[model samples]
Target: MTRRTFLRNVGLATVAHVVGCTKVIPELAALTANSVNSNTESKSGKNKLPKWKGFNIPDYFQPDPWYEIKHTPEEYFKWVADWGFDFIRMPVAYPTYLNISPKKQFISAEDVYKIDENKVEQIEKTIYLAQKYNLHVSLNLHRAPGYCVSTGYNEPYNLWNDKSAQDAFCHHWSFWAKRFKNISTGKISFDLVNEPCYRENINDTKSKTTAVPGTLYHNVAKAATEAIRKENRNFYVIAEANNGYAAPELADLNIGQSCRGYYPYEISHYKAPWVYPDPAYQPTPLWPGNMGGRYYDRAAMEEYYKPWLNLVKQGVGVHCGECGCWKQTPHDVFLAWFGDVLDILTGNGIGFALWELKGDFGMLNSNRSDVQYENWYGHKLDKKLLKLLQSK
Candidate 1:
């Protein structure tokens, strides 16, 4: 059963409904009202407000309650509303927008992936779905068209350092901004670029936490933000730091805006398969100590994410745009870290979404044939953890 149906049957329908939508959620109403006021610029520069205070959003493939999709948008909306999420994070990759030959040769959409048209539509539908569920949506460029600084997906995660590639990347955002101008300042929030990187070279014997293709990220973010701002001024334009891993010690990054600055969610990449794998990935116990845990405990989270937290506190809204683990990690490890991340977020009155509801990330582990999926991994969703996430 869907979480909403499950909750209503248990007597929480009064809190589950959304206006114009069948769901009746006072929390959403209150939240919408709060968002309205929150978006308003405060008269006193000293007073704080929030940009966003909600979840990261479910994966594009899964919006909580699993189901077959005969109609993409309709099925998706039903799926999302069923789940108790206040927002949906729409992670977009750059290739979605393609321009043939900025060169002397003839240019045409033919050079791009055919997936573009339907992809944009799917994104449009997702925003509507979020509203249908009384949830806000963040349109994040997961792996930008070219410059993927981090090494998650198998894409040529390099061009991040190339100028031409970076320009193409910025133009990609411009393309999207134009394509979905309706979503601009409307339902979708813009995220500059995914986690960038500039680390101390290992061989050089100097490594840094929050380091990556420096100005490239900054310029692209500025470019992407400007592009979106030109089209939509009200919607949030989120900025990320190098290493999706939050670094309290980093000097140049500041995601949230409290006059003092803040880093909403600290880098919680410890042990994540994206960064680390099971013992198999790291043959020795001596794994690179660079990244290996969830947010540095709660206080550390507050301290590091606090400056950003103040942005949420200020109403610019802070969205933990991404966070999820693969099946390789131990369930205990997932729970301990996710639980900590969730607690720090809520206790501090921040909002977040699970990295994914389903997909290869193993939020649902479709392939039960695997040992890890059959065993401890599936249990990652402990009752306590599930209940806490559904709380927001």
Candidate 2:
């Protein structure tokens, strides 16, 4: 059975209905009215607003099962506000809302417009909660119709190479733009795509021209940005750097740009099953050691961030959308790396969101085996990391 069908069978329909009627309806109506005014004011002084300081709400729609968001929207938003975060980057998977299956791997542009209402409703509820808690929400398509950063889920054709894939991608984004056109640009924004990294074609470290055809990253991003602008001119659109946020070419698109802080992959992704340095090798990553022929340190991190910084100098807003060291890394090393990264991000006036808030790489209740887990709000809370994030 499909995930939607399963939810219905398990009485999620009833729960959603009750929640909508009791908590969501009134707030949603009020939010819509407030949004119109906010959007106009936000555009007037976009440059003056502080950078987004927040966390990513992972796994809600990136995977099929949707397990990461275990708490109610209210509880989650309250927790974020309580912790002093001002934004939430909510990543979603396109497959969760589409009917396409393994037997039918491709979806037409027509189907792309017919989004699952249930899924949209859940997202709206999240927006409502964000509005209630005064947190900005950045809706990110982590896994777009044609591409995903995660393995085992790539589309049959390259999103950049296939005409149909590009069209479908635009349609998907246009749907959201039209649906939430009334939402305030300050309260809600769109993150065009999660990680537009095509390592085989685009170099990760430098800015290159993506204006050429077949450059899926630039082509799709531009198309989606234009499409979204057509539906809602006031919305802030964010473009992620390619390949671990190492390339800032998309910054030329003249929208908000995002950079990641996962330099020295060995340290950031230590023992990560999906990445290099296999667990069996028992790889030990030192912070200032040589990797890929360059010595890495805080200065290296600052240099690595230069491209995005250049974009900022050109008057484009930049954000550190994803940055975190794994829990398996020594706690002290993790703190040192994170502190340096955070300093660099803040030092440049670039706002940042950690990789997460709860699970691995999270501030509260991370899955670090080395730290003693302390329960707070029904989850493990790493006081040290939490304190570090809050102080910054």
Candidate 3:
């Protein structure tokens, strides 16, 4: 179907080319103008999600020639299924599946819809393997058309404010919804975006972060949800929480919600360079102890997650989309804190996905200095952390 027809069917309105900082076609000017009946208290009445526990397979996380290098091995899926886990979140960057001009780091606004079928086929292969191993695949756009939580190539426009960007974002999701229409919701889900926050400067990496306004977030998510459902009404959709911290504003959209487990950044990302930016300032993390001038324990954790739990009570499905500590944190402290994190989330019927499967924050090959690693098929495994996760 043509773009105009697709937008019309989904109730999105757009105009012709609007010249600005870059050549942008100001599409989707008002996502909710005539699209959805805005109702703050109305529930979509979608079924609640099962508490799915698994890890992130970071294969297409960035635009790299070796994009498939980090993909979870087929055996890893078997391990996850064997270990009683039922979910795997694959966070992807848009450029990974697009054929872009090598000279430019960012995709030109006009080229946002162009796709490379070969790259997409690889994505399909991974999903097929995950399903073969009985794992539910949650495909996520970690970096979307015009927004990314981390420092990457500056995008051509702002996803929150740019109509063109919103148009492209919704288009990509709609494309996926149609592509995976044959797959049952029991085996797959689409996480709309990752850690969306309102930044003072959309192009600046260090810009101060704040919660996205509820109306704007709702409009964007609702538009995407509508576009997806236009293709396949049965497809399960999930929206990540505001800034990945606050409760979601999407109960009316009939979709699942996802939140973060990196509550006290001091514990979860101790010396992670991206967060700390300086090694000297990284705090020595301790569980159930005072750090960064605040005391953190099980009580603090419970308080932190109370909002998420309350969202669940309101008939919204909630999950911890990302959690776990960087390798810099001591293993004992990491385990102690994460154990509480898992217990509170799982005990409350919310599930979690560790940030990665074989990386610094994962149970396998974490490369922590304090871990007594077990050699499992040439990969170092943190059995204690594995056992802790399984127990929850």
* Candidate whose lDDT is highest: 3
Best-performing candidate as measured by TM-score: 3
Residue range 1-392, candidate 3, lDDT tens digits = 00000000111112222212222223323223222222233344321667899998878776432333445679999999998899999988887777765335656887677788987998999999999988999999988888866554568898877888888898898789889888777888899887776665666655555656677787788778777766656566889877545445677676778987876778887877655658797668888898878888999889988888877777677878888888888888888888888988888888899977887888888888888999998999899988988898
TM-score pick, better of 1 and 3: 3
* Candidate 3: residue 20 Cα off by (Å): 19
Candidates sorted on TM-score, descending? 3, 2, 1
Superposed Cα RMSD, model 1: 13.6
* TM-score computed on alpha carbons, candidate 2: 0.78
Better of 1 and 2 by lDDT: 2
Q: Candidate 3 at residue 190, lDDT?
A: 91
Error of 2 at 195 (Å): 1.2
Please, what is the TM-score per model? 0.58, 0.78, 0.86
Q: Give the residue spans of candidate 3 off by over 4 A.
A: 1-47, 63-69, 101-104
Quote the positional error of residue 353 for candidate 1 in Å. Answer: 1.6
How many backbone clashes does every candidate have?
A: 37, 2, 0
